[model samples]
Target: MKNNIWLDGLRSVRRMGETAVVAAKAGIKYAIEKPSNARLMRETFEDLGSTYIKLGQFIASTPSLFPREFVEEFQGCLDQTPKLPFSYIQEVLESEFAGRDLGDIFASIDEIPLASASIAQVHAATLVTGEDVVIKVQKPGVETILYTDLNVLHWSTKLLEKAVPKVKFASLADIVEEIKTRMVREVDFIEEAKNIDDFVNYLNITHNKAATAPKVYHQYSTRRILTMQRLHGVSLTDFEVVKKFTKDPSQVLITAMNTWFGSLMMCESFHADLHAGNLMLLDDGRVGFIDFGIVGQLNPEVWTASIAFMDALQKTDFPLMAENMLKMGMTDQKIDTKILAQDLERLFTGVLSADPQQILSSNPADLNDIMMDMVGVGERHGIRFPRDFALLFKQMLYFDRFMRILAPYTDIYADQRLQMIQTMDPNILLKH
Candidate 1:
């Protein structure tokens, strides 16, 4: 054990030294090229590999915490990692199921990966029992690399905070720790399997037949290997193809919103990452929720406060909204409720007054700016939102953008079919 620890320590030191050299080179290149700061940062993160790529994705998704330019620029941080050779994949699969023959588990497995991401690559396969599934195989040494990079990141954030005291307001080190926790869970396929199982149970209990998550095959799944039912469909992002799937695309948005909102109250953790890539319209017209890698949970108190906050926002009750926001956030400092309400009223009303069509046409930067402005006002008024709140808000923004393409000119807040506010109840919120 001591030898192993010593070897790991040596590896960590070597990795850190290599990372510093790469960072220095990138910095010098940025200085010479005089590229945009956002572009330079995005490229640097991408070059750093898996851990930093995942961090870039988090920044892209969480517009509430990040500046508009950085958030908008990181949107290009695609998760399509280069595919690993088939021989290496075979070695991983064989090692994972050491005593068994590949033929005993899968009748046929595709050589080409369906998709490749920073942590895993997915291949379509047929189970010996005649079920179609996807095999998500983890890349070799991902955990080691992740740990090394995250440790470096933690150290760097501390240095950054000391150098720029204003950056400390965002709690850079705390955010890095949070990311580390979530990313660690993400690499563990067992935890991801349980997440999918819980979400499936929630759907079953709610009788939500219109939406579904893939079923995990525990017999073949492990920490590094996740075998699950394969979903066949077109992504929600394929706007033109989605139109062919349903005449009223607006109904699709309504269905998705209702299902997701129900999950917030029913599931142990709600899906935190719901980019268009993660949502699909199946051939059977059911909405498919894929990728249970990252999820967010809310405590009962925060859940109650969040519901009240949403209710107030829908009703345009700024005072109640301010109260609920305070309840949902963390702050020991005393704040004047009336002043906070007035600030929220001015900020929200101006944003809401814009025509939906105009808002849809506006650049992502403009929308993110509006959200950042609200966050700025809240910060000044002693509102420090929990990470879960920011995650949920970012997801709502994603759904809003989907509405523009899937249900143009439709008011999500006012849509009766959405049942956004009316469905919240103590029973659902309190359910374990």
Candidate 2:
């Protein structure tokens, strides 16, 4: 951890000077009539290595919080790390299992990693007794580096906020801060193990047979390392493969949706990052969820408000919607709630009536327009949603995208989706 911290500090100090130099060079190229500024910026980050690649992934994930142009561009950001030599792998394994010999534990270990990410490399291995597993080896000093890297992100976000008041409503700094905390939590493998356990227990309790996360090998894992059941199959993004795997991709989607939604009540926390890359189509034809590092938990009160908010939306009750948003994201200012409710009611009513399905569409309507209108209501009502509200909204937007990919015509609030929402014990909602 100490070494990681130092490396992170070194990276922050090093990047400042390099970014400035690159910015100057890019500016010069732009002055000479070229399209190299943004290109150079992107290239520079790529050249800066793994940490930058991870940051690029972060930007790609938070589309609602960033410029669409930059977010879209970073979707192609590459992330491949240098594979350590066999000698280094040996040393790391020995350090992990000091007195024990590898031969006694794993019957065989793959020299090649199945996937490599910014902080760790995952290699497939099998236990001596014939159990298959994958070991996730953390790149040394990753934690410390991330700490320093996040500080720099915070600083940059602060600069952006200070320079642009119009964009303050977006709160880039707060978003980065939230991400930093999540990332920091993710780098700790011990925490991840616990998260894995929670979800596993959740699956068992819910009796969800359609999906399962990998089982963790607690004895072989630690803060910097993890060993778990090796999960293999096609990624959800492979449409051709998906079609080959199942005739009813729509059915698979129902399973995924129900599993995730049920977790909000069945599990101790919810998996906040269930992106395609983190999900897999297992050999048994079940969805395999991985990476439980980032999660979300709503207060009981907020949960109640959430149900009410969605109920009102289902009925197109904008006055109730406005009231719920106000109460959920309580503010310290005064405004005419009655008038604000009436105006927002009129606005949502228009959209709800025009295309209630728009709530689940991906045709790229201008959210900026809807957001501006909501902001206008906020301005009038003195209703400033807390950062958490923004985060939750962003999550819903991700779900919207996910649904578009799987089943475009299915309405999440429709009777078809109720099988998922209704499986929960309704009594859980009355908790204090």
Candidate 3:
């Protein structure tokens, strides 16, 4: 125990030293180049590497917990990092499949990666049995670096909160904890493999043919290495490519939306990061859901209230919306339901009047504004939504972006095919 403590102390000192050097270099650059604080911090985060990049993304996505300027600025924090050498990737593969002949396992692995990101690099490969697959290889020392960086951030945030009691938000430490949990999960391929299996199982159970996720080859997968069936497709965002694949792209959107909405109730977790890249229109005329690194789950109570909230949204029933909102959030203060209902009515009225499409616009500025407005209204009513709400709303915004290209005129709420409440219960719509 004594030796372990000593080693841990030594590791902490080394990490602190490394962090200080990096920060000092960034500080010098900031001093020399007069950039906005937000921009400078973003650059510094990039310089600091993977953990910081993920944190920046968290900030960009969670507008409720961050300032507008910072959130907007961090949107530039793309996760595209320099790809590690192929030799390094091969080393990882060899270590992961130690004692096994790699040549027997993989017939061929393209040295040139299909994609590279902060946490992992994906390469197209073929199994010995001639099945085309993609290998997602985790970078070396990523988990160690993640733990080191998050520990530093967590400790610093706690210190700052105590030193400055008037800190902007009391949840800084909580935010760090949240980031750590998510980042750790992201680096675990086993967890991600299970996420894919669960989602694929949902597809099979529903007997859905329109959309699917890649099949996980669990026998060939590990915590650091994920092997899965490779899918050939064009991203849903590429309007022209998607058009070539499907004559009725709008129907494709509906199918994807319905599949996802059903997952909220039928599946253990819903895909949280369904951005343009992660969602695709396959060459086979099916919607492809990729990348199971991030997922969100809603409890039965939260989901029921959420369904009611959506029904209320469609009907414009302000009182029911307010009640559902209250059910989906938490607060210590007494909330006046009538006042909250009035606030929702006013907010929604103003939003719709400002151009109804803007309500569903996936433009970053527009989404941020809508989120801020909703969060502001909730704050006024002493209601703070759970993280699941944010995840759900962000995905809805992404779907809106797809709608603009595929089904601009379709009213998502009124569309008969949008199995919003029907997925949960057929009688739900009538009752609502």
Candidate 4:
């Protein structure tokens, strides 16, 4: 314990020194460049790398937790980074494999990365057994850096909370804790592998043929290295490119949505980050859901409340919506259901006037505006949504955007194919 404490102390000192240097550089840049505060903060986070980049993304997605301007600016905080040298990647592979010769394992591992992100870089490789696969290699010292940065953030948030007791936003320390939990899970390839397996198993049990996830090669996978079957496809974002692959692009998206909806009621967790880049139309005509690094699991109460909210929205039941909104969110004080229902009626009467089924707008700006309005309403009612609810709501917005591009006429709420909450089987997704 003494040795561990000494080592932790050294790491903390080093981290503090590094943070000071970064802050100084950022301060100097601010003095010289005169950039907006949000932009400057985003740039500083980018320079800080890994943890800060992830934090910026967390801010971008959780609009309920941050100011609108910061959230809008941080949307440009892309997770992409300059690729680490091939030598560094090879070093990671070698160290991870330890005693085993890499040549004995991988027949050929491409030096060029398929994708490079904050946590890991992916490369196309072939197994000695003659199967094409992709290897996701964790950057060196990612876990150590992650923990160190999180520790620093945790301390800072605690200080901030004590310093300013009446902050308008949700608890900063709680947000940091959530980020720490998420980033820790993200760096763990074993957990990610299991997420993929669980999702695949869900697909099989449902006998769904239109959607699939990569097959994990367990023998080649580790906590730092994940090897999975290589998928050949174009991202669902490119409508024209998607057209070249399938005649009905809308059907493809619908299939993906159906599978995803089923997972909400069937699998252990749902793919929380279903951005266009992470979803693909595979060569085999199946929707490929990639990147299990970020997944969300909802407790039965939350899920049930969410479903109730959705059902109320679809049916235009403002009172029921108000009741479910209260159920879905956290609040200390008693709320009047009737007044809240009246407020919700006014909000939804304006929003749902055009289309009763359209719960979310297709335009990103419009969606963000609507979310801000909803957050305003929640605040007035002394309610704050759970982070998981925000995640689930954001993905639904993503699907709404995709629908506008691929299937403008289709009504997702009314579609027979969509496994709506009303149709879901009990005793699933939630562990009894």
lDDT of 4 by residue, 1-432 (tens): 697568667866787788889989999999999999889999899988888999998888777888888888887788888898889999989978989999999999999999999999999999999999999999977777788889888887888788888976547777787888888999999999999999999888667888889999998889999999999999976877998888887788788888887788677888998878889899889899999999998776787887788778878898999889877657777999898888887776776554423543322445555676777788788988777887777677677667766777777677776664534445334433
lDDT of 2 by residue, 1-432 (tens): 697567567866776666567657667767785764335556656765566677676665554455545555665676667787555665667767878888988888898888777788888999887888998887755665566666666887777777886773376767777777777777888988988898888788656788999999898887887889988788876655887898777666667767776776666677876656677888889989887867777565665676677777777777778778766756666656678668877777765445434543322233334544555566666665543344455555445455555666767567365453444554444212
- For each candidate, give its TM-score against the true structure: 0.85, 0.72, 0.88, 0.88
By TM-score, the better pick of 1 and 4 is 4
Q: Which scores greater on TM-score, model 2 or model 4? A: 4
- Identify the runs in model 2 with alpha carbons over 4 angstroms from their true place: 1-45, 59-91, 150-179, 311-320, 330-409, 416-432
lDDT, candidates in the order shown: 0.82, 0.68, 0.82, 0.82
Q: Is candidate 2 or candidate 3 better by TM-score?
A: 3
Error of 1 at 88 (Å): 2.5
lDDT of 1 by residue, 378-425 (tens): 778877667687777767766776786667678777777876543544
Query: Where does candidate 1 stray beyond 4 Å?
Result: 1-14, 30-40, 63-73, 158-170, 315-320, 336-339, 353-367, 421-432
Each model's number of backbone clashes? 0, 3, 0, 0
Error of 4 at 218 (Å): 1.4
TM-score of 3: 0.88
Q: How close is each model in CA RMSD to the real structure?
A: 3.6, 5.4, 4.2, 3.8
